[model samples]
Every structure is written in C-alpha cells, then in structure tokens.
Target chain A: MKHTLSVLVQNKPGVLARTAGLFSRRGYNIESLTVGVTENENVSRMTIVVTGDDTVVEQVTKQLNKLIEVIKVSDLTKESYVDRELVLIKVTADGSNRGEIMQLVDVFRARIVDVAAKSLIVEVTGDEEKIVALIAMLKQFGIKEIVRTGTLALGRGPKVIQSGKD
Target chain B: MNLTGAKALIKSLEYEHVDTIFGIPGGVVIPIYDELYQQDAITHYLVRHEQAAAHAADGYARATGKVGVCMATSGPGATNLVTGIATAYMDSVPMIAITGQVTTDLIGNDAFQEANITGITQPVTKHNYLLHDASEIPQTIKEAFHIASTGRPGPVLIDIPKDVQTMTAPFDYPKKVHLPGYQPTYEGHPGQIKRAAKAISEAHRPVIYVGGGVKISGASEEVRALAETILAPVTMTLMGMGTMPADHPLSLGMLGMHGTRYANYAVTESDLIIAIGARFDDRVTGKIASFAPNAKIIHIDIDPAEIGKNVRVDIPIVGDVKRVLQKLMPMLKQTRTKEWMEKVHTWKREYPLEFEVTGLRPQYVVREISRLCPDAVVCTEVGQHQMWAAQYFSHRHPRNFISSGGLGTMGYGFPASIGAKIGRPDETVFDLAGDGSFTMNCQELATAVAYDVQVKVAIFNNGYLGMVRQWQELFYDRRYSQTKLSEINFVKLADAFGAHGIRVDSASEVAPAIKEALAVPKPVIIDFRIEPEECVWPMVPAGAALNEIIDAKSGKV
Candidate 1:
C-alpha cells in the first residue's frame, strides 16, 4: 500500500539529500518527494509518497527519527489531514481548443492562469489524485510543458507532531 | 564553557579517552581537524586512503575495546569510506566516522566535491546525522558517540557541512544522553541471573558456549572465574577463540564447523548450554532444530533482537555480557562436577584432532609457528587455516588473539594484525593467512612498512583458493573450476615493498625460516607451500549437528 509521509526537518543544505539518501539506502522506494520551507523560518516540511509493508514503514519512521536534522515525521495517511499538490500545465491554445479547455478547467475548479498566442497555462491545486486527473485531461491538448509540486500536507486542529515523541 | 563544535567533539572523545583518530584532511573537515590539533588529547593518524583509515579505525576499535574515530571530506572522500564503514557495521565494531560536507548554500547544488554524506551513510551506519545548527553539533557528536559505543556497539556517522563546523557556537557537552528509543540494558535482571545460577548448579552436563561477548563485555576474566568455580567445560565459537586460555582445563578449543573433535563432542553431549556474546549465525549452528538438541540453552546479549533470532531461548538475559557476568558472579554457587569433566575427557581422547604429518602439513606448520612464537599475537583470515589456527594454537591469554569472526571477512587479518601490533607494541604479531586471503589485502603490507610496523605475515600457499578447493574436493566431485588461483610469489611481492621475505617448502625449514624472520628487526613474510588437497577435518557439513562432524582422519563421514 502507498502512504504519504510528511516530515518537518531543520532547513539546511544537506537535509533533503539526507532524506532522499535514507530512502534509497534502506531500499524504500520513494515514488515522489517535494520539500520546501514552512511558515516557520527554521523548519522545512517535506512530503514523501512511498510504498512498503507496515513493518517497513515503522522501521523507516524509527530510522528517520535517528537523524539529527529531522524534527518530526507523520504518516499523514493515518491522520485527518489535507495533502495538496500544484501543477502548471502548458498546453497549445490556438483559437480552436482554448474555449473547450477553459470549460473543462471550470468544471474541475481549476483556473487558466496564463495564456499566450499559441499556448495556455492551467493552474490546478488539489490532492494528488485531483492534480493527476487534470494533468491526464490536459495531455489531450498536446501538453507543451508541465511541472508539479509533488505533495504537501498539514495535520488537522492544534495537534503537533514531534519526531520520537514516544 | 564556550567551545566550538569541533572542540566539544574532541572533548567528548577525551571523556571517552579515545587515544587515536584515523583520517585524511580536506577543506570541509579542516575546522574539526583544527580543533583536533588544538587539543593534546588524541593523536591523529594520517592514512593514505579514507577507506583504509576507516578499516584501521575499525581494527583499532575491535582490538582495543574502545571506540575508533575516523574523519573525511564530503562527496567522494565520504563515499570512499562506505566499504570500511560497512565492514565495521557488519562485524559490530564500535566506530564514529565524521565527514565534512559542502557549505550551507552549495550543499544541494552538486558543488565541488559535495554530496549528502549523512544520506549516503544512513543505511550503512547504526545511526547518522546531518547537522543544521552549530549549537546542536556538540550534542549530536555526544549522541553519535553514545549510540556507537553502547549496547551492541556499531558504527555511526556524523556529517557536518563546512558552514556548521566553522560557525562559532556555545558547546555544552552533555554527560548523559537521554534517548528513550536507544537506551541499552547493560545488566541482566536479577531473576534471570538467579535462574542461570540454578541451571548451572542443577545441570548434569553443563558447558559454557562462549563467543565474542567475553571480549566485548570485558568479561573474559569473569567468564574464566565462573568456569573455574563451576568446573564446567567451556567451548567457544570462532569469535570466542581467545576468551579463555587454550591450555585451561575448562577450554574445549573452538566448537562449530571445522571445530576440534573434543569441543564439538562437549557441545553435543552437554545437557545445559550457556551461550554468551555469540549470535547463532548459520555457519556456527547447522540445522537449528537439531543443534544442541538435548541441551537447554541460556543466551545472553546486549541487543534484544538477537535473543530469539536463531534459536528459541530457554533463559534469555538481555544485557551487556560483562555486566551480566558481574551480576551472576555473586549468585554462582561453588560446585564441581567430576562426572561431566571425565565424560568430556573420554570424548577428547577418543576423537582428538590428529593428522599424519609425513610431509609439510599446514597443521604442523601452524603448531610449529605457535610453539616458536607462543606469545606473539596470532591473527588469521577466515578459511581452513583460520580454523586450523583456532584448533592448534595454544592461546595463553584472553584478547591476545584477533581475527574476523562475526563477518568472516577475508581481508581482515593483515590490517587487523597491523592495528593490533600498534596497540600492543611489546608483543610480536603474526597474521597467518592463506595465499588467496593474503592477496585480498596484501596492499596493506605497505601500510605495515610505512608505519614502521613489523607485523609478521605467514602465508599458507596452496596454489589455490584453499578453502573452496577443499569443498570442491569433498563435495563438488573435484570440479576445480576457477578455484585454482594465480601463482603469485608473495615473498617477492613483500620484497618489492622494501621488506624482508622467506619461502618454506619443506617441514624442517618452517622453524628456521620463522627464526630468521623473528631475528630480523623489520616486518617479514613467509610462504609455506603445503599439500594442495588438504581439508580442515572434524568438519560439521552445512545442515548437520555438532555431533555430525566429518572425520577425514577415518576417511569417513
């Protein structure tokens, strides 16, 4: 089964590499990982989607807690949380396809943020599944370019997660 | 006290009383090395290769019972130490490896010689880190050292980028580390200790199956004392070779595959087996169900995972061996079992390790070498000869013999002996190796010569990868395949490094050749060309019990 782990780490040069390195070294397949600074200036939250057995995930959590830079890790799949991903899809937008694409974007609650003479840029913000669905639809218009912020997560309420809090 | 992270790191090491640091300097690691320079605490040994530095550090740690330290730069330098770190990890050597990383900004840009070292080393190390704040450096170093040296000791890496290392920070070195997940139990429970004593007093045929725990727990003396007081025969796993003096009445040589005839008999016949500090590796215990079938086993280890990893424990003591032994020593009763002693003695006489030496037997040469240099530290690489030395050599003290037992690493002997010699300068050290095993790390002969370390190397040259050849002869229908190795004159190879060398083709030449080398004031090599098809006998084939050893002397299984 696939699970998304959102890790809050001290913002440092090697922290992300260390995270990626841990996954690869332990033979944990990281399908996708996105990291960026949090509202807190000193901390960076990274969302990583990985597939493994329950035991392996537990081992991974314990191992991650052992690293000094990692401040916290939460298996967001277990929590009442929100995971979001943003993707900018640039598709050819000649007069023929622009109107039809804009109608589909409205139906999906996404917006066409940029438009040039030959292409249109669609900005979509949703969970990974929603983003993936929009990306697949835009591919029909002959997508010229695409970039995705993999996944970002936040826990519900006032609850805070700490690494090795146990 | 105000101190740099580097200074705090050195001070923490000083608290641990680390005597030496092995590493190569680089820009990223210079700040730490500078702090190392400021202290008169631990002397640093500049090794040519980072990998060698790591291995040397491991060797020093394994030999001296102290935490070994090594440092290197980020990227390739840190990557080079991977094999050495893995070697230590696999063998359970305590080590702290520090690496310098690219500065804060350049870290992820794939800048000049910069790579994520903590990430790279994460899986290989028992624990690892990437330092973000300079203030956390001192505590991280302490935590790394704590994790590395405590419980079942293993390697840990701390990667500090150049920016973090140089950044001035208030370093408060904590005396005690408080990691709930990492607290290692170092003493057995009182109830378990009492049960162990009860089993010992009640056992009709008791035997102590000792392993590396005796050394790692620093319990060799305690184990010896307990064995003597209880009057139980002791058999050691290969890793436990030097835990008890070989000449002691309680010592039953080594007890496993290719173990001595008597030692295997004792283990098989014993009703109660007390195993300490030895994990039940497949090589040591064949067919787990049938091993020590009639015996009740009491296993003690620091790591809880290892308790039931192999065999079901009848009484498990999860703690450090030394501390457990100390706790149990008071509970042990004064007793003697003359019947158990005599029964084992009968097995010894009936089935002694004997081979006719009409010509040059490697067994005879090992015995001769031991007799000539009884006090010299004898180290062996894993194989038939390693087993041969274990069977033949009369070790007079604990911690005097060293070899790669847990991992069964081939290239460990030469470097391990060099490290051992450096620690114990008063004693001459010899690394007894097969030609194949010798060549695995023969490059280290230069290390010996360069360090002005005269570690005597004795190679049993059989013109093949001797161990595999023995198996092929016995089991593979004599299909040699690639087991026949290259014919390299190792003596000439030793000479090319500006060292002394000798070759012994005859049995009579063995003693005189060693005498000549021992007389010389420099390191020397002696290659003994023995019978090629000779196999280490009293062999328990894979998937056989200790009692089922193949006795080649009788030409029968």
Candidate 2:
C-alpha cells in the first residue's frame, strides 16, 4: 500500500541527506519526495510518498522521528489531504499544430507558461494522476523536455503538524 | 572571563562528569592538548592507535555504565576510529567521540591533515555535530553527551574545526539539552503492558529470549523476576550472556550460530517467546522464516526502529527494558510450566556441549579463567576464542561480560580490558584473545605497562586464524590459505614492555599459568598453545535452519 508522510525537520545543512539516508539504509521504499521551507524559517517540511506494508510504514515513521534533525513525522495516508505536483513540459508546436496543442492545454485547464520559435512550454499543477495524464497527452506531440516537482502535501482544515517545542 | 573553545570543551566534559579521556594527540588537536595539559579535572590516557582509544572507551562504558569518551586528531586519526565507532554503534555502547578538524576555511579545500569526520561517521553515530562557531562548543558538547547516553545509548561524534577551537568564547555548559526531536519513550503503554502480562501468564511453552538490552538497561533483576514468576526458561543471545547468572538453572548459555542444541530446540518448540533487549540478528535467527516457528513473539525494546527490524513482532512494547519489565512484573500472574520445564530439562541433559579430551581444549582454558577470576570483567576479541569464552565463562552479573558483540571487530579485547580495568579498578579484568586478534593491538601493551592498567590478557595461540581455518576445513576442503600465522615471542615482547608474561603448551600448564598471571601486580599476558585445527561445534552454517546443526565432536547429530 502507499502512504504519505509529512516530516518536519530542523533547518540545517545535511539534514535532508541524513533523513533520506535513514530510509535508504533501512531499505524502506520511497516513491516520491518534496522538501521546502515551512511557515518558520528554522524548520523545513518534507512530504514523502512511501510504498510498503503497515509494518514497514510504521517502522519508517518511527525511524524518521528518531533522527535528531527531524522534529515531527505524521503519516497522512489515512487523513484528508491535498497533494500537488507541478510539471513544465515543452512540446513541438510549430505553425500548424500550435492551435491544436493550445486547445488540448485549455481542455486540461493548464496554461502555456513559455513559448519558443519551435515549441510551447505547458505548465500543469495538480495531483500525480492529473499531471501524469497531461504528460501522456502531450507526448503525442513530440516532447522536447519535461521537469517535475515531486508531490507536496498539506492536511485539510485546522489540523497542523507542529514541532514538539511549538 | 572568556575562554578558548578548547577550554570550553574541556569544561563541558567536566560538567558531564567525564574524568578520563582515551585519545591520541596530533597536529589539528594540539590546541586542545595544550589546554588539557593546563587542566587537572580530566585525566588523559595516551593510546598508540586511535582505534584502540575508541575500543577502550567502549569497554569503560560497557563495564561501568558510564558514557565513554575518546578523542582523535583529523584525517588519518579520525578515520582510524571508524571501526571502533561502528563497533560501539552496533552494540549500542554509550560513547562520545570528539575529533579535531582542519581550520574552517580549509574544510573543503583538501588542506593538510583534513578530513570530514562527521560526514564519514554519519551512519554509525546516533547524532553528530560540526561546530560553525566557537560559542556553540559548550552546547554542542552537552548535546553530544546527552545523545550518546540517553535512550538506546549509542556513539555520538563532535568534529571541531581548529579555528573554532582557537576562538574565544564564554564557558557556560547548558544544564539541560532541548532536542525536540530526540525524546525517548521510557515507559511502556499501559494497555500493551497488560496485554504482554496476560500473554505471559497464559503461555504454556514459554521462553524468555534475552539480548544486550537487558544489560544496557540494567534490567537483569527484573528479567529474572518475570522469568521465575512465569516459570519460563531463559535463552540469551551472545551479547546477553552476562545479563543473567550463567549458572542459573533456567539460563540457557549463549544462543545463536554457535548456540547450544537444547536452546535452539527449546526456542523452536516454545509457544511464546518473550524477546527483551535483542534485535533478531541473522546469526541468532539462522533462517528468519523458520526461527521460533511455533512461537508468538513479545518484543520489548527501547528503540522503536529495532522492534520489527528483523523479525515480525506479535506484541511490541517500546520502552526501556528495565522500566517495561518492572511495570509488567506486577501485572503478571504466577504460573507453573511443569511439562515445558521437563521437556527443556531433558533436552539440556541429552545434548550438553562436549569436546574430545586428548589435546589442550580451549574450553578448559576458558573454564579455568572463569574459576580464577570469578568476579572479573571479561572482554574478548573476535573469532573462535570469543565463541568459547561466550560458551564457557560463567558470568554472574550484568556488566561482567564485554566484547565486540555487534561489529565483531578483531583486536578489541586487549585495549578494552585496559579501559574496563580503568573504569573498575576494584575488579579484575581479562581479555580472552586469539593470536590473530592480539597481534592487531598488542602495541597497546606499552600503554598498559606505562599506566599500570593491570589487565590480564590470555592469548589462544593456535598458530592460525582458527575461525577462518575451521570454515576452510569444514566447507572449503581444508585449504588453509593465509590461515597459518607467523610466530611471535610473546614472553620476550612482554619483558621488553615491562609486563609479566607466561606461555603454556599443555593442558596441565594452563591452570598454573593462569594462576601465576592472576597474582602478578602489573598487566600480564599468558599465551596458551591451543590445538590448531580446533573448531567451534554445533555449528549452523550461515542461512541453515537452527535444528540442522553440525555436531562434529560425536559425528552424530
């Protein structure tokens, strides 16, 4: 099964590597991960997608929490949460096919973020499935380049995952 | 008054009650050494090799339950401590390893005598720090010691740059550390304890499988109480040997690859396995899928990471072993397991460990050591000698037996014995070592004699790397390539180093030599000429089922 975990860790050099090192050393499977600064400058939040059984996920959560840099870890798999991934894809759109690609982008509710003499750069932000689907549709037109930010997540409503000190 | 970072570091160590430091001085660490020379609060023991310093500190901690401290200079010095650091990490020994680094400006420039010690030790340490400023020295040192001694207890590293060490800072060690991420759970959950207690009371064929955690948490008494009340026989892992009295009727000597036949049988047949302070290592489990096949496991460990790391735990209680057992003991109902006890007794009687009596048996040497130094803190180097000591030495207290359990590092015993002697001067300390391992750190004999550490080192001189030779004889068709060792005149070496030395070639001389070595006022080395081809028996080849053991003595099982 797939589990999403939101981990809060102290802002410091090598903290990300150490947190990720635990997962790799213990052989825990990580599907996708995204880390960025949080509301506080001294803290950073990491949203990791892990695929394992109940026991494996539990061990990962506990092990992550054991790291000295990590302040808090929560498995958001069973909770209501919004997850998003942003992808910038450049596809061949010279002349005749430009209108057709723009039409497809409009249908998918994505926007053209950049334009080149030979191609158009489409920006899409949504859940993994929507981003994946948009990428698949754009692949019909020759894809020149693609970059994706791995999934980031937040819980719904007033529930906030805070550090122990906070 | 403002003090240099090096002085502040020393002050913080004093604040943490660290009186002894095992370290070697070098270029980057000269500033700290200069400051140390000016202070009388902490005594320093100079080691020939940085590795031995770490091992000695580990021995001190294991023997006395205090956080051991070791220091080394940059580059080669810091790298040399890796094996010992990993050794302490594997066994969960509480240790603080401080290394002096190149100046901050030259950190990544590949400057002379520079090394990224923290980066190198990342996986082995519980936590590590590289100071960015001089003022952070006191708090970092406090945090390092706290992390090293608290919770599951493992080695922590602090790498201080030379520039930072020379910078001036106000010395004020923090009274308490505030690490929001590192709080350890000490008390077991009430519902889980109740469940565990109920399960123990109801278990018919129950076995308490003990591990090093029992000793680490000082929970031997609590374990004994719970075991006796529930009438469960105890089988301990190699690291768990001294956690309970070895002579106790319920105690099943060391269990694992070289574990006894009956202990393996009992575990296989048991209905409930109460695992305490032990992660199921591959050596202990043989084949994980088949280990304790009929048993439902109740694992009690302080580290949540270890609860299901290797084995599937049916009931997991995450807490300090001592605290968890103390709470669970009262909730448990006393019960008798007469039928199970009878079966276990029969197995024990039928399959006692035996060896041919013709030549000088290593087991006899170990037994003599135990008899002579009954209260001694025993340390061992890795290999066949370690196994024999684990099997034969009768340990009466929790801290009595110390060895390189987790990492199984060679050449650990001698220096560790020195550390143990320093930690507990009132008690005798012995290093049961093999010729191969003794040669690794025998240079430390000078350190011992100079300081009068008075640790007895008994070498099992088989003229070969006995354990590797055994593997070759059994599995590789007796091709002893590089197994035979070049000879050394230990007695002459000891004399040159100003220590007592005795060599015995026969079984009759074993006891007398040990007696003589024990009476010596200074450090002593007794070299015993053991049978070259002797192998540890009841061997379960790696990955084999526990029951499929090779009993070469009788040529029968």
Candidate 3:
C-alpha cells in the first residue's frame, strides 16, 4: 500500500537530512518526496510518498512525529485530497511525427515547453496515473530525456494541515 | 549582561541549576574550560577519558533523576563519547553532551581535530545543534536541556565551534521554550484508560510488566500501588530492576533472558499484561508470536512509536507512565485471584535461583555484597557478571541499580559508579564488574582517587569473557575463540592509582574484603578469583521463547 504523508517541520538546517535519514534507517521505502516552505516562512512542508502496509505505515507516521523538528504529520492517502507531479518529457520529433506529438500533447492538456531540431520538451502536470499515461504515449516518439518533480499533495475542500500556532 | 559565548554557556547551565559536570579538556574546548575555571556554580570532574565522562554523567542522571551533562573536544574526543551517548540513548537517560568543534569557516575544510559531530550523533541523539553564532548559545542550550529531559528522555548534543565560543554575546537565558514540534502527551485518553481499567479489573491472571520508563517517570510508588490494589504480580525488566522492591510479595523479580523462571512463566501464562513504561523488547518477548499469547496487552509509554513496535498491543495509551497510572487508578476495581497466585508461587518454589556453593562463585560475591550493603547503589559492567549481579542483587528503590541495560556497554559500571557516588554521596556505591569489563576504564581510578570518591569495585576475575564462552560451550562446540582474557593484578593497579586494593581468592574471604573496602575512605577495587567457566544459568538461548528456559539442574528445556 502507498501512503502520501504531509509533514510540517521547522525550517532549520539539516531538517531535510534528519527527515530523510529516519526513513532510510528505519527501512521504510520512500517512493517520492518533495519539500518546500509553506505560507509561513518558518515552517516547511514535506510531501512524501511511502510504500508499506497499514501497520508499517502507522509506525512510519509515529516515527516521523517523534522527530523534534516535525510539527505535524497528516496522511492524505485516505482523505479526499489532490496530488500532482510536474514532469518534462523530451521526445524525438521530426516533420512527420511533430504534428502527432503536438496533437497528443493538446489532448492531455500538456504544453510543448521547448523545441529543438531533434526533440520537443513537453511539460505536463497531473496525478501519477496521468503522468505515467502521458509518458507512455510519448514513448512512441522516443523520449530523449525526462525530468520529474516529486509528488505534491494537499487535502481537498477547506481542510488544511497546520502547525496549530499558525 | 554581555559575556563570551563560553561564559554564556556556563551561565545557561547555571540557570538550569546544573551543579556538576563530567568532562575532559581538549584543544577546541580550551575556551570553554577557561570559562569553567572562572565559575563557582558548577563543579567539573576531569575524567580520564571522554567516554567515561559521558557514562559518569549518565550514571548521575540515572541516580538523581536530573539531566546529566558531559563535554569533550571535537574529532577524537567527540567520537569517543559516541558509545556512551548511544548507551544513554538506548536506555532513555536524560543527558546533554557538549562538544567543542573547529572554527565555523573551517568546518567543511577538514581542519585539524575537526569532526561533524552533530551529523555523527544524528541517530543516537534526541536532537542536536551546530551553532554558528554566539547569540544562539543561550537559546540553544535551553532548548537542548528541555528536549533532553522531556518525554522519552534521551541524549542531546550541542557542537559549538571554537570561534563561536570566543565570540561575545548577551547572556539572556530564556525562561520558557517554544518548541512547536516537541510537545509530549502527558495525559492519557479517558476512553482508553477506562478500557484498560476494565480489562485489568476482570483479568484473573493479570501481571504488571514494568520497565525503565517507570523509573524515569518517578512512577515506582504508582506501579507498586497498582499491583497491590489489583492483587497482581509485578515483573520488571532489567532496566526496571529497582522500580519495585524485590522482596515485595507480588514482585516476580526480572523477566526475559536470564530472568527468573517464575517471572517468565507468570508472564507466559498471564491473561492480562499491564505493561507500564515498558517496550516489549525481543529479550523480554522471546519468540514474539508465543510471548504472552493469551494476554491482552495494555502498553503505556510516553513514546507512541514504542506501543506496537514489537508485539501486538490491545490498548495503547500514549502518555507519561505516572500520569497514566494515576488516571487509571481511580477507574480500577480491586480484585484477587487466589488460584493464579498459588500457581505462580508453585513455580517460584520449583525454580528458585541457585548456584553451586563449592567455589568462589560470582553469584556468591554479588549475593554477599547485597547482604552487606542492602541500601547501597549497585552498578554493573557488561558480561556474565552483569547478569549475575542482576540475578543476585535485591533492589528496593528507584535508581538504586544502574547498569547498561540497553546497549550493554562493557566498561559502564566503574565510571558510572563514580557518578552515582557523586550524585548521592550519602549512599554506598559499588560497581559489580568483570575483570575484562573493568579493565576497559580502570584508568578512572585516578579520577575517583583525586576526587575522593569512595566507590567500591568488585571485579569477578574470571580468565575468559565468561558470557561469550558460555554461549560457545552451550551451542558452538566449545570453540572459545578470542574469549580468553589475560589476567591483571587489579590490586597492584589500584595501588598504582593511589586507591585501596584487595585480592580475595576464596569464598570465605569475600565478606571481610567487602567490609574492609567499605571502611576505606577512598576508591577500592576487590579482585575475586572465581571459577573461570561458570556460566549464568536459567538461560533462554538466543531467539528461544521465554517458556523454553534451560535450568541449571536439568540442563534442558
């Protein structure tokens, strides 16, 4: 099972390493992780995707909460939430296949961010399934290179993961 | 008031009311030492080694329930404290370790005597800091102390650069700490407490399993009260030895590997296990699937992660042990089970702890010491002697028996005894040590002598690392590789260090030597020559279930 956790921690030096080190030392498998400052400059939010059973994931959440810098941990996997990952794919393009690639990108609502003589860089943002589908479709055109940002998540509606003080 | 960062550090310690420090001076720590020399509020004990300093601080914390503090220079000095820090971390002892680091600019340049201490201690410490500015001294020190001594107390380190120590800063100690992420749950949930109380009241064969958390939370009285009120037997883990009186009728002594047979049996047969302040460690829960298979476990610990880390927990209450016990006490109904008590008593009578009385046995030495100094604080170094001490010595007060329960550090007892004596000067202190373990930090005899610390050490002088040899004899075809330890004349070594020394080779001479050593005003070491191959009995072979115990008489499960 996969659990996406939203962790709020103090914006201090080595916070990332401390959080990452825990996952490695405890043998928890991390699928994807993204960290950035939240609305409050003093606090940072880490969106981590981990794979474990219910018991192991519960232990992981509890262990993450034990770190002194981690203010709060919210598992958004079960909740009604929104998640997105931005990926840029460079596909081999020629006069014949360029139109098909552009047409395919339009259908997925993706943009051709960069164009070169031999490749076209398509930028797309969606959930994991959509990104995987886009990459699979672009594979026919031959993906020259690809880069991806880790999965970022947030709860739906008005609910939010706050540090109580904020 | 404006002061140097080093002075600010000392001032912050004074604000925390720290009366003593265990530390060694080094190049990077010279500025801190210079400031320490000018202070009258805190007395610093110059230990022979950095590791001993940390262990001594840990002993002091265990004995006094205060946050222990140790300091060392960077690089080698800081690295030496790693084992002691890990030891304290594993046992959840409240400790602050201050290490001097190289200048901030040279931190990543590999300057001489520089080390990334905070990075090195990340896993072992509850939290750590690497201060680049002198102004952060007061706040960092306060936070370090608060974090170290709070819920699930553990070691915290502050690595201060040399230039930061020399920098000037305003000395203003914060009266309150604002750590958003570090608040611990001190109160148990009302619904969970009710459930636990209901389970306890209805349990016919209930057992209370206690751990070091009881001592750390100062819940010894509460634990005893709960057991007595419920008419339940109490079994303590090794770290929880002194939390309940060993002579109490309900007391089942220790449980787990090398634990009393009755304690293990009672737990194995228990219908309800009210585990207070205890994590179901592998040693305590051998063959986890079969450990207390019939019992409904109620685990109460300050650390939530410990609740179901091992065995399945029925009711988990994440709160301080003392507070949780208090909340649950009012909801409980006193009940008795005469049949269950009788069964436990039968097992106790059948499997009483015993050893041969023919030779100068290590058990005999520990038993004699317990008989002579009933109120004395006992510490033990790792190996066979540690298990023997745990088995033979009767503890009646919290913090009275301090040993390396978790990490099982080899040379913990001797230096720890020095700190224990310093913390509680009125009580007699003894380090029940092995020849191999004691030799690791015997150099601390100089610190003990110089400070007039009257700590008595009883060295069970067996020629081999007896515990490892026992494992080999039992399971490894008696291939005792690298277990033999060359003997040293401890009496001469003690004399050389300006401490009293005595050697006793016979069982008849043990008591008299202990008495003589007690009367001596300074540190004393007694070398008791015993049977070399004597193994700690009542053994549960590694990975064996608690019920599969091998007794000395039967030599079989």
Candidates in order, TM-scores: namely 0.77, 0.98, 0.98
The interface root-mean-square deviation of each model, in the order shown, is 5.9, 1.5, 1.1
Candidate 3 lDDT tens digits, B1-557: 88889999998999999989999999999999999898799999999999999999999999999999999999999999999999999999999999999999899998999989998999999999999999999999899999999999999999999999998987888888889998999999989999999998889999999999999999999999998888899999999998888888899999999999999999999999999999988888888988998999999999999989998899999999999999998888787678999999899889889999998998999989999999999999998999898888988888899999889999999999999999999999999999999999999999999999999999999988888988888888889999999869888999999999999999999999999999998899999999998888898877988999987665522
> In model 2, what is the error at residue B453, expressed in angstroms?
1.2
For residues B1-557, write the lDDT of model 1, one tens digit per residue.
66666666677677767778878899788888888777786878776667767777877787677788888888888998887788787667889998888888887898999877766666678878777768887678778888888778889998888887666778666787756445577878889989988988888888898887777778888889889888898888777887888888788888888877787777777788899988888777777887788889999888765677678789999888988888888877766578889988888778878876877899998898889998888878878788888888887666667777765777778777877777777788888999888887787778778877788988988888888887787778888989888899877898998778999999999999989989887789999998887888878888888777787755332
Best by lDDT: 3
Candidate with more favorable, higher TM-score: 1 or 2: 2
lDDT of each: 0.81, 0.90, 0.93
Candidate 3 chain B has its poorest 10 consecutive residues by lDDT at B548-557
Each prediction's total of clashing residue pairs, residues at least 3 apart in sequence or on different chains, is 0, 0, 0
- Better candidate number, 1 or 3, judged by lDDT: 3
lDDT of 3 by residue, A16-36 (tens): 999999999999999999999
Which window of ten consecutive residues has the lowest lDDT sum in model 2 chain B? Answer: B548-557
TM-score of chain A of each: 0.89, 0.94, 0.98
Q: Pick the candidate with the highest DockQ.
A: 3
Model 1 / residue A13 / CA error / Å: 12
Q: Per-residue error at B332 for model 3, in Å?
A: 2.1
lDDT of 3 at B36: 89
Select the stronger candidate by TM-score from 1 and 3.
3
